[model samples]
Target chain A: MAYSNKARDFFSNELKNINTAGTFKEERYIESPQGANINVEFPVGAKPKEVLNFCANNYLGLSSHPEVIEAAHQGLNERGYGMSSVRFICGTQDIHKELETKLTKFLGTEDTILFPSCMDANAGVFDVVLDKEDAMISDRLVHASIVDGMRLCKAQLYNYKHSNMDHLEEKLKETQNLRLRMIITDGVFSMDGDIAKLDEICDLAEKYDAMVMVDDSHATGFMGKNGRGTHEHCGVIGRIDIITTTLGKALGGASGGCVSGRKEIVDLCRQRARPYLFSNTMPPVIVAAANKVIDLISKTTDRRDKLEKNTKYFRDKMTAAGFDIREGVHPIVPIMLYNAKLAQDMARDLYEEGIYVIGFSFPVVPKGQARIRVQVSAAHEKEHLDKAIAAFTKIGAKYQILGKKKDEIIAQYGY
Target chain B: MSDDLKKLIIDYVKKEYLDDDSEEIDESTQLISSGIVDSFSMVALKTFLEKKFQISIPDEKATTEAFDSVNNMINLLKEFNVA
Candidate 1:
């Protein structure tokens, strides 16, 4: 009774507005495990349909791998199901320590500290390391989790243009008066799928006496030559002051994250990061599975190489199909459909055609930049890619959008 | 600032943000305050202004109030000596 109808009415009206905007998100039920192929049921009551998943974050296709399953099983056996307490409590296990050591080696960082998720890592990092006297300069397109973390901190926050190094340098130059300046960016922007210019960021950081942080969640498992991450890809591995990433994506598609960087910074994270201190520690099963994943990627580049090849092939064919695919070498290929309703309609149509991809609209992306973000995975073979490309072409033709530009598409479907 | 400069700014906003080419805004219309352009678009517009005018409008000077309208934008540019 204390929770009034006024509050209820507010949320109801807000949801109605969202529905009217054609941007209301609905979750599809998935019966199977996460992978390139999943059994999905849309709008809740419909029978589940077997669909080729083109929307998952399973970049390396290891989410449902037999070896990964076995490792997870082994882990569940060796170290029970869950950690009932936080890390500083009785939750820290031997496997957790082992995984940290392996991650440190794999990442080429001096130290590493684990969190329940990368969101937790981002949430806990800033307030622990920075205060009002410091300044945090973020790329305009950095992940939302980093933005939320910044909101919780008292530091002066500024944003440079997306991937614009000159703007970043200018911000850094002007912020030299602050006690510390931290330049933060995502390794690969999730929407645009463009790689960050980390080498230039590092040079600017050095010139301005600033620290650098990269939330390399999207690029952690298969970015560089050895898959160390964007730092390795950009040839600035040991120079990054803080490297935050996740195990929830390509690493094993389980849930865990870490803040890995300078030994002292990680030490401070362990001692002070609120999420690590307050939330329950990462489960031991994920630690054991992540250990196997790190070991596998460390020994072989087969999966990542396959992923890269598959991505390039898919991108080339999609471009040839005349879809307005965002130009990127990353697997997060956003097919730009400027209208929200068009994006949703295309996604629904593609789902009916047995391809599962989600449409992203405003506020997930900027207004008028709505699209269907197709995530290409290594599990998909040439047949899958060909079928997906054919499906897209057919759908594009149906919508009369195959050969259209942004303005043309917008004219057909309002932005 | 010259009337030509204000027209140029208004034209850029119409082309980029209001691409429908139907809705109109004069020199005194609210841009940022009325949600015609958000912070992200403001940065993009700031980038355009900087490149077009060859002036560095520092982040602090490019406030919401400064970018709220074509008139305010012109005033901020006037401080930068962009006529």
Candidate 2:
């Protein structure tokens, strides 16, 4: 059968254009599972093996943790491999309930619902809760998943400037007559690593009678005293109405997510969210492993302590080397490179120095604000961090970007 | 071209995609190719168009080519008696 021109055009010209733009990213396959340092096989022409792994979501050195692996193995033996159904269907295992219950206790919430991935947790949220009479006011710099979820709902949407409480309050006032109002923000923004103003957002939520939701994907496993999330970092854990976070980032670096909050809201999400209703339940092994992760995280503070120290060490050293770094309390450290080509070039050179980092550019972030987002981890020792810093300083001098700042540019413009 | 319909489409696109005002969107611009329309945007547009035009865009016509450019989208809407 002949395909439609639409399909032909999509597969031919448009797809070709997108791929040709140097933006079509292909994943580098890792022979081993994710960890602090992983070995990835390169393409035919390039070197066979590249060392140094600075690009991963495994913040606590727990992706390959021995206990987590054993727990996963035990679950596989007990519960089998796959669930083959959604959570409401024949997929709710004992481990799933255990994980959900533990998550509720860990987050200090009324209840929790698990999704197969954090992306789905984000994509499924708004459709379930927000109606035509509702409003969702969000931050300008929240994750892509939150934005996607908000689009799926019938709620009136407004975006305030990032972390700007005044704009958020104004939006809250504008939408006060709506049946429901929610102010959504990221606990720790992934790109720039900036922490959100959750305390202020919660105060405004109380003042305006609006509910607050925080996507704590980046903050969940390491931010608070017990790694509860950004709300814990801000000392307002129970004040926020809803918390959506990923198990994928720091909670063992596996793939899972949960929405924890008031039981009514979670129950509604379970009933209506399309991704949740349609997607298969998480596998038994993954669930068991994640359950153990929740258990481990609640009991220990070692990983969080290590990550905090590494972050401070790297941030301090990078600043001393005269690099303009984005200010934040998270492991996501953005080293700003204003030009797109410069960012790409710097990433390439960094890799040549046996350090792995990715360049963030336009479409992913605002234009003229591209950077190398170096993620610190509990796995990184002092030697690893110092070596990475030396590599950065060397490349910075080579690229003539060592001492350039916004002030320097303004002075050059004679402003 | 009724101003209301044009404004409705534009408003839907602007709000749903979280588009900034500086990104020069025009009727001839391709929403998908220009990165204004991703998977979730596609889902939202599908739902919105179904309600607005009172006709369903068949699965065959739901590819990026049909919804890419605003002109192309308008043409598809014409099939559903939009204009």
**Model 2, residue A82: displacement in angstroms?**
0.7
lDDT digits (tens) for residues B20-81 of candidate 1: 55889999998876656766447668878898999999878989898899989888888978
Model 1 steric clash pairs: none
Residues A1-415 of candidate 2: C-alpha lDDT, one tens digit per residue: 7899988987898768877765777677667767666666655345446557787888888899999999999999999999889989899998899999999999989999998887898898887888889988888778888987887787876777678787788788878888999899998888888998888888999999999999988888799888888989999978988899888878888788988998998998889877889999989998889988888888988999999999999999999998889876788999987666778888889877878899987678765577899999998889999989999999988877777895663343221
RMSD of 1: 5.6
Query: Against the correct fold, how does model 1 do in TM-score?
Result: 0.86
Is model 1 an incorrect, acceptable, medium or high docking prediction?
incorrect
Instruction: DockQ for every model, please.
Output: 0.09, 0.10
Q: What is the interface RMSD of candidate 1, in Å?
A: 6.4
Q: Candidate 1, chain A: TM-score?
A: 0.97
Cα displacement (Å) at residue A169, model 1: 1.4
Work out the iRMS of candidate 2.
5.6
Candidate 2 lDDT (Cα, 0 to 1): 0.82
List residue ranges in candidate 2 displaced over 4 A.
A4-9, A44-47, A407-415, B1-83
lDDT per residue (tens digit) for residues B1-83 in model 2: 74566677877676555435555566776687655675434755776788777787888988888888667778788787776
